[model samples]
Target: MDTSTWIGIFSVSASAMCMGIGSIAPALSEGKALQQALSSIAQQPDEAGTISRTLFIGLAMIESIAIYCLVVAIVLIFANPFWNHVIAKPGG
Candidate 1:
């Protein structure tokens, strides 16, 4: 009901949403990438090493986005910027 309480609720909800969507997208992307990489390696056995190496690097880069989202969600939940504003307000 109060401003601080509302802020906390919204922060937690936003964080949860961010984490859920963020993790799911990256997981799906990683799975698809892996599948494609495997298919490529199978088709070109001679270039398996190169394909596999490139796959890993690309996967790492993609995974970084999810990690960043997780970090942002954690910060939102645990150290939200609006928390200070709401708490500092009178009768919050």
Candidate 2:
């Protein structure tokens, strides 16, 4: 009913949505990337080392997206900037 309550609800819901949607895309991308890398490696066995190294780096980069989402979710839940704004509002 209050601003703080609304902010809390919004923050939690947003964080949940952030994590849920964020994880799915990265997961799907990782899977697809892995599939492609594996197929490439299979086709060029002699280039396996280079392909594998690049695959790991690519996977790590892709995984950073999910990590960023997780960080955002955590910030929303635990350190919400909106919470300060809501709290500092004039006699809300």
Candidate 3:
């Protein structure tokens, strides 16, 4: 295969891997966060509001990691800088 084909294959494989691996951590973290939040709420019913609010903020922050990975994967598959380099090269 040529360079362009190689880049295409790499891009697709990388994107798939990124998304597959990326989602797992967030899923786990979200589950764990929810579990801890619920535990805290159970332990301190009076502070449930604070604990829940902080949990939401923390979850949102953690979720941003997955979102960033998704954006990177999309860029790799659809807007790779290597594509420009490959296309611009002379004589294949």
Best by TM-score: 3
RMSD of 1: 1.8
Off by over 4 Å in 2: 85-92
Task: Give stretches of model 1 more than 4 Å off.
Answer: 88-92
Off-target runs (Cα >4 Å) in candidate 3 are 90-92
Each candidate: what lDDT?
0.90, 0.94, 0.93
RMSD of each: 1.8, 2.0, 1.6
Per-residue alpha-carbon lDDT of model 3 for 5-92, expressed as tens digits? 9998899999999999999999999999999999989999999989989998999999999999999999998889998789889975
Q: Give TM per candidate.
A: 0.84, 0.85, 0.87
- Kindly list the per-residue Cα lDDT of model 2 for residues 1-92, writing each as its tens digit: 97799988999999999999999999999999999999998899999999999999999999999999999999998888999788788885
Clashing pairs in 2: none
What is the lDDT for 49 in model 2?
97
Query: Which candidate leads in lDDT?
Result: 2
Q: How would you encode candidate 1's per-residue C-alpha lDDT over 1-92 as one tens digit per residue?
A: 77788888889998999988889988999999999999998899999999989999999999998999899998997778899777777877
lDDT sort, best first: 2, 3, 1
